[model samples]
Target: MSTTFEEITRPDNGPLVELNNNMQEVFSQYRKMREYASYLEYELKQKDEHILKVENENSFLRDKHTTFDSNGKSVEPIIT
Candidate 1:
């Protein structure tokens, strides 16, 4: 005689089989959400580093431009 899948896995009761299937589905969805959260965190770190590099370059160029006047006289420092 051949036995069906449900009969072999859950011969005791019908409700128990349904509960087991539901639990498996919930766990699968949780795993995918965790992976997406990790990807977003990595992207945020890269953007922060790029912003700092641009700010440093702007400061360096401003200093070089204002170091001397057109008549070759020293220019007074401007307070931030």
Candidate 2:
């Protein structure tokens, strides 16, 4: 007597499709994060410029305070 065996094939599930869609959403979120970081860098540069300008102005004012009066007298002390 001879016995015959049948081969079985497995069916594909839909979970793989959902995973691909989720990966696409993650990539989109990553792009948005990069854009936000770029915007922050630009803002920081502007703030640095403003800070430099203020420091220079303060230095000029301090120098002017060191000058004596027309009668050759000392001036009042100014807070830095």
RMSD of each: 8.5, 5.8
Clashes of 2: 0
Q: Given candidate 1, what's the lDDT at residue 15?
A: 82
lDDT of 2 by residue, 1-80 (tens): 99898997776767888899999999999999999999999999999999999999999987877767889787786679
Q: Write the per-residue lDDT of candidate 1 for residues 4-70, one digit (tens) a residue.
A: 6654463676688889898888888888888888888888888888888888889887777677879
* Global local distance difference test of model 1: 0.82
Candidate 2 ranges with C-alpha deviation above 4 Å: 1-13, 68-80
**TM-score against native, each model:** 0.56, 0.62
Which window of ten consecutive residues has the lowest lDDT sum in model 2? 8-17
Off by over 4 Å in 1: 1-13, 68-80
- In Å, residue 46's CA in model 1 sits off its true spot by 0.8
Cα error, residue 8 of model 2, in Å, equals 9.6
